[model samples]
Target: MLPAQICARNERAKAHSSRYNSKRMKVGTGRLRPHRSISAGHNRDDKRMKIGNKSGAVAFAVMFAILREFVMKFVSILLALPLTMAISACATTSTDASAPAAASMAGAKLMAGDGSARGTASVTEAADGLHVLVKAQGLTPGIHAVHVHMTGTCTTPDFASAGGHWNPTGRKHGMNNPAGMHMGDMPNMTVGPDGSGAIEYVIAGGTISGEATPLLDADGAAVVIHAQADDNMSDPAGNAGGRIACGVLAAG
Candidate 1:
């Protein structure tokens, strides 16, 4: 119904319009737009999840480090407590042992009646036990009673002023008797005509240190020689009268 050239032109125009509309329809509803938006959202979510996972990992690492530190500190404290207690116990034990030995080494000395008949006494350690060595010059020549007395005073006309025999246990006299006599009572001391005597005897009761028993108090005590022989049966003190020589017993 139209010229050949015009018909060709119209047909070409329709073809072009159809192609463009088809392309537009396909872009709007075919899957490309929604697919692209969904893909981008998925990528964003994945990134957010990765960030969250990394944050969680960091937190877990920090907590683990703190836990490790706490555990180490607790273990160290536990270990130190016993070691400290052991050291303290050792120190206390050592002090206890040394205390008695030190007390025995304290100052000790001896004297004679009115300090006239002077004698020197020494303390020495023996395998058996402590030994008291007493040597005296100038004394009566006969069997005499030798006893440890109370008090350290040496100045007096009659040394009897030094007080009675050293009776600490408050027991009756006579070492041979069931009742214990004074601590100072000793066997008879026999002196030669030369008026000299040497006596060696062990301390029967206990050691010089107060750890075992107190031989001499802080004020000190005395050892004396009696004028008469001890019958060895008398109570309190032997009939022995008059203190001839005296010595002060100290801690040592």
Candidate 2:
């Protein structure tokens, strides 16, 4: 009876031990399952982070490229503006430098008068045309006809002739009349009792070139004062009588 009781007790003890061992193994397996799931979730999070960083890097590179292109365009425009203005200014200066300057005639002797008449003439450029300044002294008061005549001849005691009025186009006498007027025909000069006359006006169509027939040529010309006043309409010389005084024109 004692031996049978001992065997039953031993059997009950072994069955309880087996059940505790099985329960411990089940608990450990449950903990290991959670750890494996956590590790897998961490791996997935790492992959997502790597993808986001790569995308952000690509976006930054694209933004930098756009900014660089915009900056280059802006700088190019800034460099060209001043160069255009400088070229325009240089062109204007060159044109002004090529224009003709004023001319003058001094210390000239008259062919007709006994006493020498001192006169001065000047030419200046203007926007519309040329401004001519002429002054004569030691002359009779009244109206005298003044003209720019042809020929440089003033070689005689009598001084009866200085050739004819400078008529390059072979025209007649008149002022502001295009067709038949002498190139030398100008407005009549009125002298005061002081024996001095000054003439000032603008000549619209005149130049100082060898190609065109300039008033002042290589052979030179004469500014002569006639005895009588010009009729202002005569064909040859406006019937302005004889040449009273003559002054030779030459380049200085």
Candidate 3:
């Protein structure tokens, strides 16, 4: 009777131990699954962080490019400033240099007493004296006497309204007068066969518009051409004939 009971009890004990070991293995497998899931989540988080870092780098690069472009434009403007100012200054200097030449010239248009001869005269002040340049056409082809008359009036026919030769020095009229020639006395102008002539004269101690005896004076002056040549030695008129052309000297 004792041997059978003992064998049955031992078998029951072995079965209980087998069930406990199986349950422990199932619990270890569940823990392993949880660890795998945690690892997968960590991998996903790492990928997101890497993507964010790359985006930040790209944004920084874009900003740097924009800033560099702005700097380059600013540098270009700074480099051009001096050239622009230089061009402006050159223009101003050129305008300033041309001021005196425009102010120093005087002009006159001459007409014959009988409306036959016509001419132009330009007066300029040089370093030496006053330069008088006369150009004429439609005049007789011979030696003609040209003089600066005292009065500016050139009224008609004989043109007697224009007074005597301009003698601010109170001297005689002729160049060969010996006592001292008048300031208005000039050499004879010989006209060509085509009736065209030119004369240039520099009157010593005479001016267009200065402190000296000016052609454009209070009563003004006249450029007069005589029909005949002056003999260069006669007293008042120098034997010069009638006044052919006369022009008033006006301030311009």
Give candidate 1's whole-model lDDT. 0.70
All candidates: TM-score: 0.54, 0.56, 0.59
Which regions of candidate 3 deviate over 4 angstroms? 1-103
Top of the candidates by TM-score: 3
What TM value does model 2 have?
Answer: 0.56
- Local error of candidate 2 at residue 31 (angstroms): 6.3
lDDT of 2 by residue, 56-135 (tens): 99999999999999999999989988998899999988887897543433224454566454576555544554455668
Top-down TM-score ranking: 3, 2, 1
Task: Write the residue-wise lDDT of candidate 1 on 1-252 in tens digits.
Answer: 569989999999999999999999988786667888989999999999999999999999999999999999999999999999999999999998887444453223444545564566655444454566667668779887877666766555567656777676776666676776766667777888998777877756645545444556655566777788886667868688777777666554
Candidate 3, residues 20-75: lDDT per residue as tens digits? 99999999898889888999999999999999999999999999999999999999
Error of 1 at 40 (Å): 57
C-alpha local distance difference test of each model: 0.70, 0.72, 0.86
lDDT leader:
3
How many clashes (backbone N, Cα, C below 3 Å) per candidate? 3, 2, 0
Per-residue lDDT of 140 in model 3:
91
Model 2, position 166: C-alpha lDDT score: 76
What candidate 1 gets wrong by more than 4 Å, as runs, is: 1-101, 105-114, 124-130
Q: Which ten residues in a row have the lowest lDDT in candidate 3?
A: 99-108
